[model samples]
Target: MNIILGASGQVGSNIVKELISHNLPVRAVIRSRNPGFDSQVEIRTADLFNPEQLTDALEGGNTVFLLTPEDPASNDIIGETQQIINNYKQAIHANGIKRVVGLSCIGAHVEANTGNVLMSRMLEQGFADLDIEKIFIRPSYYFSNWLGFLETVEQYGVLPTFFPEDLEVDMNSPIDVATFIAKVIAHKSRSSDVFELVGPQKYSSRQVAETFSKLLDKHVELQPVPKEKWNETLASAGFTASTTANLVDMTQAVIDDIVVPENPDAVCLPTTLYQYLKEKLEK
Candidate 1:
């Protein structure tokens, strides 16, 4: 049996659908019932932080897809991740699951000084000694995250950003990420491996704005917010102090180029930023 945690999320849901499209039976472990999934998929409701509940959900599963959701309400980012890793450890042991595919970030190879990347880095490290065969999919930033900026563009004719305006960065659609995961599941090879996923094209903030302009048929300018004012801006935006601080650190990592893909020769997924944006706009 194959199990998928975070089944309601963008990447996880896409993965669930992809697996089902291939006629693979999947057990979706979710915190709450979401009727979005097809009837062929099995549903298991459990709080991910609950060891007993998670263990029960993993019962008889041979493979598992793991991802840790962010809890901005918590002040202790590292502590929260540690507890999650611990829970996964306990659940994996209880079920004796052997094959695994983990969703991680691109900068996960950085051992230190890369704020949010540390959470992913530590996640991969935690699974190192396990006897199970594992493949970690470290993808670039999700293109879906930019959807939130469309409202700003529509209202103010500008897209706000924290990073440098011309800094080129990797991007990928969640659908593409899921498709790659399905491929990995079908062809499980290495005992432990990492695949760096990215969209067909890299985009800077200006390029992003240009893409938006082309899609929206309006001139959307790039508004680069100075890093010094992030705290005040995030606070005004209603983010908790801890969440704000964590985001600031992660943004800094991007500015420092710590989140760039480790493998320059990594294959680009079929989806492009323009294609993703076009789909969203058309919808």
Candidate 2:
């Protein structure tokens, strides 16, 4: 059986749908009951932080999809994430799981001080010694991240971003990510592997604004939040001081061009920014 953690989330939920489309046996593990899953999916409620609940959730599952859910409001995000990783380690061992497919980030290879990316690094390192097939999927910036600024773009004709106007960054669609993950899980592979996933092309903030302009028929402009105001901006968004600091560091890392895939030959998914935005707007 294939067990999917964080099954309520976008990527996880899409993965569930993809697997179900293939008529595979799946157990969806979520913190709370969600009635949206198909009849074939076995829903299991389990808190990721609770060892006993997680262990029970993993019972009889041969392969597991693992990911650390984000808690941006936490005062100690790193420590909290580490604790969750420890719980997963314990639960995986107790259940004797055969394979683990981890959702990581592009900059997860960096060892120290990469803000949110550190969580992925910790996840990879935490399970390094475990005698199981480990496959880490490191995806670039998600195109869905831009959905948060849709209201601002629609109402004010302005797109707010931390990136520079002309700086191109790798991005991918969550649908593509889920599709790749489902295929990997369905395929029988014994050797451990790391796959870096990206979209067909890189996109700049200016290009995103242009796409919005074209879609909304308005003169949308890019509003790059200056580095000096990152802390102020994040704090106003209701993030804790520590969380804001970490986010600022992560933003800086991106601007400094530190977040690159370790493997040069990354798997490019066929989802352009314009296509993604067009579908989102149509929806």
Candidate with top TM-score is: 2
lDDT of 1 by residue, 35-145 (tens): 489999999998977899999999999889998677767688778888888999899998899988899989999865787777888888888889889789999888987
lDDT of 2 by residue, 1-283 (tens): 9999999999999999999999999999999869499999999999988999999999999999999788768898888899999999999999999999999999999865788888888998889999999999999999999999999999899999999889999999999999999999999789899999999999998988998999899999899999899899989988998889888888778888888888889999998988988998998
> TM-score of every model?
0.96, 0.98
- Runs in model 2 deviating more than 4 A are 33-35
Q: Which stretches of candidate 1 lie over 4 Å from their true place?
A: 33-35
Candidate 2 Cα deviation (angstroms), residue 209? 0.6
The lDDT per prediction is 0.87, 0.92
- Provide the lowest-lDDT 10-residue window in model 2: 110-119
Worst 10 residues of 1 by lDDT: 182-191
